[model samples]
Target chain A: MPTVYITAPRDVAPEIARTLVEERLAACVNRLACDSVYRWDGEVLTDEEAVLLAKTTDERYAALRDRVVDLHPSEVPCIERFDESDILDAFGNWRAESVGEG
Target chain B: MPTVYITAPRDVAPEIARTLVEERLAACVNRLACDSVYRWDGEVLTDEEAVLLAKTTDERYAALRDRVVDLHPSEVPCIERFDESDILDAFGNWRAESVGEG
Candidate 1:
């Protein structure tokens, strides 16, 4: 399983999260308030962003990433994969059942 | 580098996050509102929890995990490691400099 970290505007975060679950692309999604600081065009910039942690199986990861990119507002969205090395056994099974071939 | 996933009581989440950054155990921490559903004591439990995403280097992970265990209130805290496979190059360099040698 891979947990995807995607950042988007705060206002649209809930919609994106809801859509993922509704479409069964993600088992569950967690959104957090994030203050992002980055360098853009040779200047420091900061923005209030929402970070979405989407849980999905490896079989469904490519689809999840594609859907995210399709809906994302940024031209170059931040979609990073964080591989699951340690997770609760029960929770892991729950996620596996929640997504894919459903 | 690793991004550690931690869950803590909402009220205490800030304290745990602050300590990690202040002590240089983590380069930074992101706290998000998480509604967790799990089976506990043969019953499904739903909790309003805070999820902490702590970013740190491989060299500091052991110390960071030990410190978290020491400071955490829960007997068995959820301290899972999510290995970073994709990340912005500049941000990766920044994290390496932020912890474990200063």
Candidate 2:
């Protein structure tokens, strides 16, 4: 299974999450409040952010990625996909059903 | 490289994250506040939780998993490993250095 990780500003996290679920791009989206420190424009910056872990499968990844980019607020959002060797069977089934025909 | 995802109670999140980094099991830990819905003992429950994303490498996964299990509060903690096909080179180098010699 593939889990997509996306970091967005705190204020827009919920909306982005809802869109993914409503559009059937993900079975579930887990949101976490985080303090992000990274380099940009040759300077290190720290900011409060929200990380969304979207549960999907290999088949749905492309569509999910496209939808996320469309709904994202940042011009170059941090969108990354992760592959897990072990995923709970029940959760995996649910994800497949949620993103049907993706 | 591997990113380990662990879910802990909000109260213990910071400690677990700090321990992983301080002990060099992970280069960085990103914490997120989350609402988890899962099944336990034949009942479905929802609770406030924290998700920790630990950045490390393949060589350190075993030790990191063992140490996380030792330090975790839950009897069966949610410790899952994720692999990314695309990791930024700079971040990957930093992770490799942080978890030196596994």
Candidate 3:
């Protein structure tokens, strides 16, 4: 299994996280509430957002990406993936146990 | 090995990343150059910084942490770890190969 960090608007994050979790598309989705400031179209934009750091298996990524894109508010959502080796053991086990038999 | 995100001052990120990689404490470190705004000492502080999202193994974490703490400039550096399964296969493979016999 792997962990991925997914960032989206707070309003839409929960919906996307729930859909993925219910489908077992993700082992678990840890939601972090934060204020984000970034640039788009040469304009500095700031907003309240929830970053969904989802944990899932490698096999689940494509489906996860597709579902997130469909459900996300942004036309181009930030669905970045990172390697999972850095996770602590307890957290890793929790994430693994949350998903399919891993 | 696992991927860990180590956020530090730009002046220090590369030093920490390099030391970890050269010592084989981490497989590879991806340097993300960005501006960071965070609260500390009851004050809002912002700075141009670099975040080192280092990749290493579960077994290597303790040693890596010790080394990082010894080397980091901050009194309490951000040595956060996350699950790495979200990483693309190619990146995962690269990270694995960069470390010990993975």
RMSD of each: 6.4, 6.3, 10.5
lDDT of 2 at B20: 75
Whose TM-score is higher: candidate 2's or candidate 3's?
2
Instruction: State which candidate has the highest DockQ.
Output: 1
Q: Over the stretch B1-102, how does candidate 3's per-residue lDDT look in tens digits?
A: 455667788787766776777776776455656788999989998989876666676778788888888998888888877654344444445445555532
Clashes of 3: 13
Of candidates 2 and 1, the better by lDDT:
1
lDDT of each: 0.81, 0.79, 0.69
If ranked by DockQ, best first, what sequence of candidates would result?
Answer: 1, 2, 3
DockQ of every candidate structure: 0.22, 0.19, 0.12
* Clashing residue pairs for model 2: A33-B33
Off by over 4 Å in 2: A1-32, A36-47, A50-102
Q: Alpha-carbon error at A26 in model 1, in Å?
A: 1.2
lDDT of 2 by residue, B1-102 (tens): 787899999998878887777677777677878899999999999999988888778988899899999999899999998778655344466557766552
**Which ranges of candidate 3 are over 4 A from the true structure?**
A86-102, B1-102
For the predicted complex of model 3, DockQ is: 0.12
